[model samples]
Target chain A: MLYREAGQFKTTYAADMAVFPIRQDRIALALLVAVAFIAVPFMAEAQVWPFRTDYMVRAILIPFLILSLAAVGVNILIGYCGQISLGSGAFMAIGAYSAYKFATGVHIPLAWLGTAISIPPLPGLISIPLGGLMAALVGILFGIPSLRIKGLYLAVATLAAQFFFDWVFIRVKWFVNYNSSGSVSAPDMYLGPIHINTPVERYLLCLSAVVIFATLAKNLVRGNIGRQWMAIRDMDIAAELMGIRPLYAKLSAFAVSSFIVGVAGALFAFMYLGAWEPLAFDINRSFQLLFMVIIGGLGSILGCFLGAAFILILPIMLDQIPHAVGIPVSVETVSHLVFIVTGGLICYLLIVEPRGFARLWGIAKEKLRLWPFPY
Target chain B: MVEFGQFLEILIGGLLSGVLYSLVALGFVLIFKASGVFNFAQGAMVLLAGLALVRSLDFLVARGIPMPVAILMGLMFAGLVMALTAWLIERFVLGPLVNQDGLTLFMSTIGATFILEGAAQMIFGSDVYPLPLFPTDAWFLFESAFPGGILVNKLDVWGGLIAAILVAGLALFFQRTKTGRALRAVADDHAAAQSVGIPISWIWFVVWLVAGLVALVAATVWGTKLGVQFSITFLALKALPVLIIGGFTSVPGAIVGGLIVGAGEKLAEAYLGPQIGGGIEYWFAYVLALAVLLVRPQGLFGERIIERI
Candidate 1:
């Protein structure tokens, strides 16, 4: 009965169009945000029961938040626009390396023509979004093929971007600032004078970014452009006939998606990994994010978070379960089992509910609205 | 003259290596043509088949079984394993997933890839097992034309011959066999074929089995060349560009696509890699495929895509 929206009345168009039009949903969202921002950090600081160790905050939460951000990006393109991409990893790499370049200071020596240009290092906060912008630019370039290619063919075509970027980052010394070993470490990150040093600060940063990006994504999808994307996805020929320019709809999806994923990549490299090589953003990373989008629910903002948590936490949980239960399994065996279980779960989920966890959540909510009663 | 000979050598080498890719691509073409599911698990299947064959062969050899008999038994064992895998996949994964969109099926096959890769490695042991079935030596041609004759690998020649035979056999099968007609019928229209009393599940199973056996043949050459290991799965990635270039549906398209990709990448790497940063071979074929896609979205030999509202 509490879950029912019976008492909620929209007095204005703005109220009706609000993302959380249901009073309960709005309250729940506020509570979640508050818990994330205040309670979780405070708990970690105070060493509360579940937060007794920083491992949860450092290892699990940070990666989960960052990856969820990336999944949100992938979902926009694949889920909303209906263009399949297997090159999200390459976009991530581009974001990361470009951010690294901007953060460290770019030096361009026109030695062949006897001129030199250099950019002084920018702050970490500025470089992160800049990295996303850079990724967006490249994403649009790679997405050009989608105009001609569709479906599985388009997906395979995106691999060109993945492999090409992989080679660029590995072969070009400039991207890494000519580091002797070719791996680059994150420069000290600062917001004005505040150093984002601790896991709590990193977690908060990711939380805020995710909130902002997700809201923006939600609004975009609910607006005219999102409709255009959905139209194109549902039927491109009909969409085109209705004056939805496939070029604008498809490319904009790429641009926005890559921008968000790029920010996630920057955060991932700077916050989670700290020190990384090109290999950190390999094709497997692409697959991982895709899995998150798929398992979470396509075309749903809430699904990104659900999917990310499921994909990221499942392996860790699986690893811990056998150990906690006193089963002596080798690390190799556990890893293999993780693969088998993950694969099996993907198949199972696709067969049972192709829309993913978000749909399941929706079903549960509908049931809740009818709790303690029946027709 | 020396440079020309070297260029010819590289071209020949690339084309031969491309044949190995074609063998793997053949598996993809078979499954895709019949079932319309792009089998991302093709490379993993190759790995599984190779591991099964090599592991069993080693076991039989260590037990003092005669060499020829052991090879025969090992092939049979691997064939049996592939048959079982085909049944499991068709019955469990693809059967329930019937009538779903192609993308979902594609994603499920990817899931199947992960499962096969993990299970094969876990069961058969993940260590690289060498299959030294082919001779690995070099031959020189046109000795009088250049300072040294154009170099060619003996193994590559064997691979070319095997690929030609495999393609010929597949052609004969498709053209002459009753099952081949059924497969074509199913590929043309699944619903119509079903209505005509064709067993869709059985046809899918046979296609997958044929694909699996083709993977066995590929694994034999590739395992002998590079040794069977986890890295063999990367061949699936390599074959994708070939698939797109050749067209997803055509077998002959696969061979031609492989040749173009192989020769083009090797040529680019040799001629342009040094000028750039090298390792362009990794992306060359894909970029070539992208270029082809721009020109012919259906692929060079692929059927023209006709979209409906």
Candidate 2:
């Protein structure tokens, strides 16, 4: 009775076409935002979850947010666009390295109509999107083959991007600013008087960025472009016959996906790992993001968040479970167990619920309205 | 400028490494041809098999077993582990998700890859194990025969020879054997083969087992050269360009693709590395393969992909 949408009639087309048409959804979203903005920051860091910064905010939420952003990007390409990419990590790395460069080395002199002007270097806040644009350009360049190759063959072709970017970052000193050690520290993120240095600040910054991107992603999918993407994904020839240009849809999907992914990469680097080497964004990172999108719920925006939470929090929970039971588990044993459990769970999810957690949640909601009735 | 002899040495050396890459790619082709599941776990299988082999060898030698006997026993243990892996995959991963889409199956294999990698590391401990090099004294002598002092590792020559024999053996098996013909049929049409009295799951099990065994042989050869370690699993990415250039389903294509990739990579590194600050070998094969793919969407040796409305 509490969850019912009864008597909530839509009076206009604008109200009916709303993202959250139900009044209850708007309230829930407001409460969620309120809790995230207010309650969490006030709570001190502790070993226990929910109130614990170490467990909840730092270890779990930060990575979850960053990965969710990346998952959204992957979801757009693989889920919405019908393009299977194995090089999400490559795009991420490009965004991160480019952002790092922009934050550090973008102070240049512009000669405009015989007048010389020195351009001030932008801060990390501005550099992140610039990094994303670079990745978008690169993503579109690599996406040229999608016109010809589809499915698994297209997936393999994308690996060329991953390996190529990886080599460039690792071997070329210019990308890493000639850091001989190959490990680069993320530039400080500053905006006037505000300094995003603390974990809370970092969490807020990442959360806001992810929320903005997630909103943009949802809006994009709900629009005509999203229809075009689904058209191509379902059947490119059919979509093309329907007057939806395959090249435009496919390339736009790549651009949008890579842009979000690139931003996520910058956040992943600067926010999560303070100092990172090229090895962090290897092929495994791409696989991890793909797994997130797959298990979260393909093509759903909420699925990205859900998938990221499930994947990132799983190992941490597994690590702590033995200790909670007063049995000391070796780190290596825990690591191995995490992998086996994770792999086993993925197979189970694919077999039993290939639609993933989002669909399951939808089913649950449907069942909830039926009350005490037995299906 | 590099001497003509030096160029020949690089070319020969590259061809040898390419042959090794073909062994890995051949394993992939076998499984892909039979099941249409591009088994991503092939590299993890190699790592697991190598770990089993080397660990078993260590166990035998520690107990004062003779060298030849220990080696044979280690090989047997590795084979046994591979067989067990095939059974596990058949039972859990493939059987339950039989009619899923291609991407779902591929993703499942990725899960399988992680589980195997973790389990292997847990069992064997993630330390690199070096094997005694197989004797190729004649190859060493030939290296000395070349001018400009370009040295070739004798073991690499033997690796190439073994790889050639492996390809020939596989070709014969596919040509002459009933199971091989069944695998080919399954590759051609799964439902038709199942209706025609070919057991699809059984064929899948055999393909995975055969692929696992191929992985084992490759691990032995590669472990001897590079010392079986974590990086070997990533070498699967290296073999990818070979698979792309040649074709995913063809054995001879893998071999030819490997030769082109291997030779091309080495030549680029030698001739163009100085201009690019070196290490061009890493991405050169992929770029070359991508260029080729642009010209022919169907790989050089792959069957033409036909799309119908």
- Per-residue CA lDDT of model 2 for A66-119, tens digit only, reads 999999999999989979999999999999998998888743334566554433
lDDT tens string, model 1, B264-309?
Answer: 9999999999999899998999999888888887777888888642
Which sections of candidate 2 miss by over 4 Å?
Answer: A44-56, A107-119, B136-138, B141-145, B148-150
Tens digits of lDDT, candidate 1, A132-202:
99999999998898887788988987888999999999999989988889899999999878999999999
The DockQ scores of all candidates, in the order shown, are 0.69, 0.61
Worst-scoring 10-residue span by lDDT in model 2 chain B: B136-145
* Best model number under DockQ: 1
RMSD of every prediction: 1.5, 2.8
TM-score of each: 0.98, 0.94
Q: How many Å off is the CA of B76 in candidate 1? A: 0.5
